[model samples]
Target: MAKIEPANGLKSAESRKSLRGTTESLALTDGEGNPFGSDSELNAYTSERQTDKYGFIGGAQQYSEHSAENIPPEVLRQREAKWLDMLNNWDKWMAKRHKKMKLRCQKGIPPSLRGRVWLYLSGGKVKREQHKGKFEELDSQAGDPKWVDVIERDLHRQFPFHEMFVARGGHGQQDLYRVLKAYTLHRPEEGYCQAQAPIAAVLLMHMPAEDAFWGLVQICEKYLPGYYSAGLEAIQLDGEILFALLKRVSPLAHRHLKKHKMDPILYMTEWFMCAFSRTLPWVSVLRVWDMFLCEGVKIIFRVGLVLLKCMLGSQDKLKTCQGQYETMELLKTIDTRYMQEGFLVREILELPVSERDIEKEHLASVRRWKETRGELHCKSLPRMHGAKAIMAAEPPSRQDLRQNPTIIVESPLATKSNGEDKERKKTKEEKNGKKNSSPTPVAAYLEPSEPSPLLKDTALLGSNQSLSSTEHDTYL
Candidate 1:
C-alpha cells in the first residue's frame, strides 16, 4: 500500500501505527461484518477469496504493470515540487493557471498527487465539505434490500486480483459497498448499476470512501449525466454519436463495422461505462483517466476512435478478422505493449475531435434517438433539478450555439478561432503602443448565498465554481 502522508510533512511513527490499527479494525471478515442483504447466495464469494476462472473477476484480462520505478526519482521530485507549489496556492493557480494545469494533466498527474488532484478536478473536496457526515449517516442505515442484494453479488467480482480486494470482505470491498449504497440513497431515481461498482472501486483506490462518493457524484452528474440511469439513454445516444464520428473520421473502419452489422453499443458500452478501466492495461488506464478527468468524456471518444482505427482502419489487420466474433475479440483485447505512452497519448491528442465536436454530435444523436422512439418528451434529456432544470428546457438554437465560445460548429464568426483572437488582439495592442490587457475574467458560478464552512477552513480558499454559464448551459 502507498504510505499515507499529510501534505505538510510525514506523520510520526506513532501516528502511522495508529492509522494501521484503525484500518485493521475496519477490515471485514466472513463473520465479522454486517451482511448487505438477506440473500445467502452472496455468502459463497464472501467466505474466502474467489479464484473462479469463469467469473467476472477471473475473466478479466491482466496486463503488465506500470509504475514510477521506471522514472528517475529526482525528476519526479522536481515535477512534484512544481505541482506542490501550484497546489499550495490552488485558488490562485486555478484562477490564473488553469491552462497550465490542463497541459500538465495531459502529460500525466504524478502517482503521489493523483488522489488529491482527482479530488480537485472533480470538485470532490468542495462537495465533501458540503456533505460532512452524510456518508456515515447513509452508511449507518440499512440499505434497500433490493439494491443491497445486487451490490453484494458484484462486490467480490471487482478487482479480485488486487491486494486491496483479493481477500473476502476486505477493506476495498467494504468501502465499495458504502460508496455505492450511499449513492443509491443520495439519488434514488438512478438507484444502482453494476457498471458503477468498478467506477467507484477506482475512486476508492485513490481516496477515502466519503471523498470517493462525492467524486463519483461529479462523474455521474457533471461528467456523464444520464449514464447510470434506467434505460441508459445517454450511453445509447453516445454510441450513435461515436458511430457518426467514426464514419466521418475513419470511414473505411466505419464501413467495415457497418457491413458486419456491428453496433456501437456492442463494443463501446463497457468502454464508456467503466471509462476503459476493465479494457485497457493498468498503466494505460491510469494515463487515460488523467486526461479523461481533465478534458471530460471527449477523451473516451478519442481513445475509442483510435482503437477502431487500429482494429479495422488498417487493411492488413482487417484481413485477419474474418467476422464479428474475431472483430469483437480484437476490439476488447487491446495490446498495450505496442501502445507506448509517448506514442498513444500523442495520437489521442492529435485526433481531430474536441469537446465541442462531441457536444455538437451528442445533441444531434439524442435528437435522432428521440425521434425514432417517438417519445412526446425528450426522454433522452438528462435529469436535472431547480435552476438546472429550467436551463435544460430551452432548446439549443443556432443563435445560442453561435454565441457560446466553446460550441465550435460551422459559424462564420467562429471562423476566427480563439488562437486567432489572441494574435489579433496582440497585434492591435502592439501597434497602438499599449501593453496587452489581461484576458476577460471567466464568469464563475456556484456562488453560495451564505459563508461556506470551507472558507473558514482556509481563508485564502475561494468558492470553487462550475463551468461558466454559457458552458454549463450547453451541457444541460
Candidate 2:
C-alpha cells in the first residue's frame, strides 16, 4: 500500500481493486506494474526521502558509523579488496582456513556486497540452486486464506520508516508479501508467525524476493529450527538457556533478573525471533546480522548478554531497577552508548560463550523441561552455528556420510583353485612318467569395473549413495 505518486504515470487503483482476486499472482509485478521478474530498480524512486548510506529513508535519529567513528575510505577499500579475494577463493577458505573466513566476518562485510555474502553465509544461495523454481512455484500458488489474511495485515508494519516498505503496497511490500506467502506455502504445517514480517523485510532490503525466501528458509530450518513453528517451542527452550547462561556471564545481572523474577521471554522474544532486526539501530542491526548469519544464534545470545551486563551489571545500574516495570523500561530503551557498532561487535566476539558450552546447557535445559512435560512441541534442536554447519547438516552431506566405501577384493580365489588343481595333476603326471603335452596354466584375477549386486554383501547396513572424490566446495 505504498503511496504511489501520479507523476509516475501508473494507475495503481485498478491493481488494488484486483488484488483480492490476484493476490497469488501479485508476485509477478513490481510497484509500477513492471513485469514480475524484471527487477526494475528497487530504490530509484527515493525522490526527496532523506536516506542514509544503508538506504534508510527517514529523518529519524539513526545510529551508525557516523554516530561513533567512521571507517576510513582507504581501510574500507582494502577490506573490500580482501573480501573480493576471499569470495573468489571461498572454497579454499571454507575448506582449510575457515577460521580466517570467520575472522573476516567479525570485521564486517562491505555493505555493497552484504547481500551476496549473506547468501553465502546462510547457505540460501546453495539452497536456491539445489531446489530450482521452488520459490516461484510456491509464489504462483495462492497462500492459505487463514495465513494470507494475517500476512497482508502485517505488511505495512515491517519497517514503516524504511524506504522499502514505507509505501504500504510498494514493490518492497509486494516482494515481502511474496517471500512470506511462499514460505507459508513452502511450509504449510508451520503456517505463519508475526515476527517473520520484520525478518523478511530486512532480507528484502538486501536481496531479491527469491533469494530472500531461501534466506528465510535457511533461517527457519538450518539456523534457528522450530523458531517460527507451533507452540513457540524452540525459542522457549533457548530462553531458559539464555537465563542459565546469564547466571555465569553476568552474575549481578542474573541476580537482578532473578530478584525481579523476569523471564527471558518477556524481553528477549523479539530480539531472538527477529534476530534483533527490530531492536538495534540500523547499522548496529547490520553489524549484528553480519555476525549472526556467520556465527548463528549464539551471537544473538552474546548481544543480549552484553546488553544486560552493560545495563544492570553494576550496583549503581541495579539500584534504579526497583521492580519489573523499571527493569523492562531499562531494557526497552537500549542506550546509544551500548549500541555503538564497534563496541558491541567487539564485546560479542570476546564473550566466553562457546558452542560446546551452549550445547551442554541446551541438553541440560531440555532434560529439565522434559522432567515436567513428557513431550516438547518441536523435538528438533537448533542446528550448530555457522554456514559450514548449515551445509554439513544438509541431506547431501548426510548422504555422503551414510555412504559405505567401495571395497574391492582382488584375491584370485576363483582362478587360483583351478590353477592349483592343474599343477597337482601335472606333478602327478610327471611322477607317473607321463609326457606333458598341455601348455603351462597361470592364475588370472581382476576387480570388476562395475559392482554387481550379486557380489554385494547384503548384511551390511548402509546407503547405496556413492561418495564423491571431490570435496563439496562452498562456492557458487
Candidate 3:
C-alpha cells in the first residue's frame, strides 16, 4: 500500500530529503520518564528563552500547581511517603488494594513520582522489560522512508514553547523523532499520524525515548486503541459513545448538540485523542494523565461529560452559545478554572462515568454504526479494559465490574476499614447500654424486579429506541 503523507502540514519537497537518522543514540545522566523536575536546558540558539516553573520557554516563568499539588511541605511529604509505600508494594496494590491505589491516583500522583507511577500504572514498565532492546534496536535503525520525513517535519511543531522542543534540532525533538519513527517501525501498518507527535512529545518530557516508546505503545494499544490509526475509526466510535452518554448525563447539552448538529468529534476529538494535553494546562494535563493511566479511558469520558454539562447545561449558559461554530470555539478553549488540576480531577471523579456505562454505550454505538455506516471500515472494535486496566481481561463484561453504576460518586474517604466501622459500632453500643445481637447491613443486595437487556438488539440506555446520530475523529 502507498503510505499516507504527513498529517501535519510539512513541506513535501523538504520531506523527500531525509531528516537526521537515529545513528547517534541519546545517553543521559538521568534515566526514566519521571523528570524529578523540568528537563529543559535553555536552547542555545534561541534568544527567547524563559522557562516556567512547570517548564515552558518564551512565556513568563510561572507556577500554576494544581490545588492538590499546592500543599504545605509537610502534606507533600505525607503524600510522597504514601506513594513510596505504594510503589514498593505495587503488585499487591494492583491485585488486592486496587481501590486504595485508584483513590490515591484520583488525589494525584506526586510530580516527582509521576513518571515512575505512570510506567507502573500503564504497564509500560512490563512492556519495556518484556521487549528489552526492541526500542533501542528500532531507534538505531534508519527508519521507514515513509514516516521518517513527516515525523521529522512535525517534531518542531509539537510543544514548540516547551524548552524540550524549542530548538530546531535538540534532544527533545531528536528523542521525539526517534520515538515516533520507532513506532512506525514497530506498527508499520498503522504508520504515522500527526496526533501521535504531541502524545509522544508529552511522554518524552518525563521519560527517555525507549520508555516513552513503550508508554506510547500502551496508550495506542491498550488505553485507547486505534486512536492514532490511519483511519482513526476507534476515536470515531468513542465520539459516538460520548455523544450517546451525553444524552443521559446532560439532556440540555445533548439537545444543544443535536440542535446545532454539533458533532462529538468537533469538540471531543482533540480533547480525548490528545488526552486533553492541548486543551488543558500542563499541570492539569499531568493530573488527568495520572488517573487516565490508573483507571483507563473512563476518566476521559467523565471529563468530556463534565465539560459538556458545564458548557451547555443551564438555560443561561446555553444562551451564550448561538451556533455550532461558537460552541466548538468554547470547547476548544476551555476555561482556566475548569482546567485546574485540583478542580478538574475532583469534578471528574465526582461525576459517575463507570466502565460499564462506557461498554453498554459502546455496544449500542457499534450496533448503530454497523447499521448506518457499515462495519468500521476494516476495523474491529477496540478492546475495552477490565477493572485492572494494566492487566485486564478482553472485553470485560458487566459481571466483571466491582460496583454497579450510580448517580453519586463514592468518595475514597468513605472506603474505611471494617475495624473503624466496628470501633464506631462498639462506641454506639456502649452509649446505648444495650446491643442488638445483629445489626442490618448498611447495603443490602436488592434483586432487580426485571432481567437486564444486556444482549438485546436495542438501545439499552433508552427504552429500546435506536440511537440516531453517528459521532465523528482522529484528533491532533
Candidate 4:
C-alpha cells in the first residue's frame, strides 16, 4: 500500500532541506510527529529528477557522436566550391556542344533558340545589316504587274479563317504580304508564287517582317533549289523525294497507296505548298516549322516519312472508305510529329546507305507508275475553284460589276464552269465596245469616294493618294 503524509512547506537545519524528496522515509518531521512532506510530491520530484538525468545524458551522447563524424567548416567549404566548379564546367560543355551542333546541322534547333540559330545556319547574320537597306530600296520601286496581281489576289486568302489571323486584323497576314511583295519586287524572275503564302505564314510565327523576309530568301535560294520557278519544277522534284521517303519508311502503306492508285502528288501538294500549314493545326505546324528552320530541307523528307509511318496502321481502315473519304480520313487520323520524331528516326538511322538507295529506287518505280498515267499533273490544280463557284452563285452587285469592265470578264474564271466562261466573255466584249463609244470618261471609276472603314483601316494602301486608276480597276 502507498503511504500518505501531511503537506508542510518546511526547510531542514543541516543545509536547506527540500519539502519534496524521493523517499518518504527521509522526510523530516517536527516534534508533534506530523508528516512534513506528501508522498505524491516526493514521487513527482523523483520522477522529474529521473527525466532530467536521462535527458542530459541523452543530449551529451548525441553531441559526442555527431562531433566525431561531422564535417569541418573548411572541408564543407571546399566541397561546395568543388560542386560549383563541376556545375560551371557542365554549363561550359553544354554551350560548346550547342555551338558544335549548330555547325553539324543534324536536327531542327529548338524553338527558343531559333532566331539566332537560323541566322547562323543560313549565313544571313553575315548580311543582316545589308538586308534592311536592300529591302527598303526594293520597296520603293514598282513591282512586276503579274506578281502584284497574284499578291493582291491571295493577300486575304492566306489564313482567312484562322483565329490568330482574324484577331490581329490580319497584322501577321500584312507582314507576310509585305515580305513576299518585297521579295517579289527584289527577285522579279521568281516573282510571287502560290507556295509563298504558307511559307510566309510560317516565318511570321517566329520572326519580324524584315528578318522573316531574309529567312525566306535563304530558304528559296540556298536550302530549296528552284522553289519559286515559273513552272514550279523544284516543287515537283521535292514531291518526288517525299514520295520516295514515304515508301522506304512504310512499305505496306506504300503498297496500299499503289493499290488505290494513290499518287503522293495528290495528298502532298498542300504539304509542299504550305509546309503543312493548311494540312495541320497551327500548333503542330509550328513544331514542324521549328525543325524545318533548324535542320534545312532534310527535315521535310524526314517529316514526310514520319507522316507515312503514322498512317501505316490505319491503312486497312482507310481503304474501307470509298474515294475522297478514305483520303480525308487517313489525313485526319495520322499523328504527324510523333511518327517523325520517334518511329521513323529510329528505323532510318539503323539502315545502311546502300539499302536506303535501293528503297529510294523502289519508290521511284511507284512514282514512275503515277507519272505515266498523267495522274500527278491532273491533281495539282488549285482547290479554290470549288469555293469560287459558291461565291459566283451569290447575287452580284450590278453597280460593282459594271463599274469595272475587266472584273466582269475575269470573274467567270472564278466559277471554273465551261458554259459560263464563253457566255461571259462574249458579253464582256460587247459591253466594252459600248463603254468605249460613250462620251463619259473612264476616270469616273477613280472619283474620290469615302473608303469603307474595313478598307481604310487596312495596311494594304500606303496613302489615299497612292490609290491609282489601275488600283481601283483591280479592286473592283
The lDDT leader among the candidates is 2
| Tens-digit per-residue lDDT, 140-233, candidate 1 | 9887888889898768656654544655576778888989999999987678876787789887776667767888987888777777776565
Runs with alpha carbons beyond 4 Å of true place in candidate 4: 1-113, 130-132, 160-164, 167-170, 313-315, 318-325, 332-476
Ranking by TM-score: 2, 3, 1, 4
Per-candidate TM equals: 0.67, 0.72, 0.72, 0.49
lDDT of candidate 4 at residue 385, scale 0 to 100? 14
Best by TM-score: 2
Question: Model 2: per-residue lDDT, tens digit, 1-476?
Answer: 12222221112342223222112232234564332323233344446456776656552324455555577878776776676566655656667888887888888877656776787778886787778789889989988998899888768556655656666577888988999999999988787877777788788777677878988988888778887776666776888889999999999999988888887766677778788877777778888888888888889889999998999899998888899889988887778778777788889989999888788888998898789766776656557697778756763332222212223333356457667777898899999999668864442322222222233332212211111111111111
* Count: clashes, candidate 3: 2
Candidate 4's residue-wise lDDT over 1-476, tens digit each? Answer: 01112111111221011111111122233343222234464345445433221121111111223122234656554443432232223223223543444332333333333443454344343344444488667667777776767676555444433322322234655676678888887666567665676677655555556656776776666555455555444455556666565566677767666666665555555565555655543434544555455444554565566666666535565556455447545654455344333344444334332324533553575477466643332122221111112123332233322221211122222334544555676678788873323322221112112121122332222221112211122121
The lDDT, on a scale of 0 to 1, for candidate 3 is: 0.65
| Candidate lDDT (C-alpha), each | 0.62, 0.69, 0.65, 0.45
RMSD list, candidates in order:
18.6, 16.9, 18.7, 36.3
lDDT of 2 at 177: 91
Pairs that collide, model 3: 33-206, 33-207
- 2 against 4, candidate with superior TM-score: 2
Off by over 4 Å in 3: 1-49, 58-62, 65-69, 380-387, 393-476
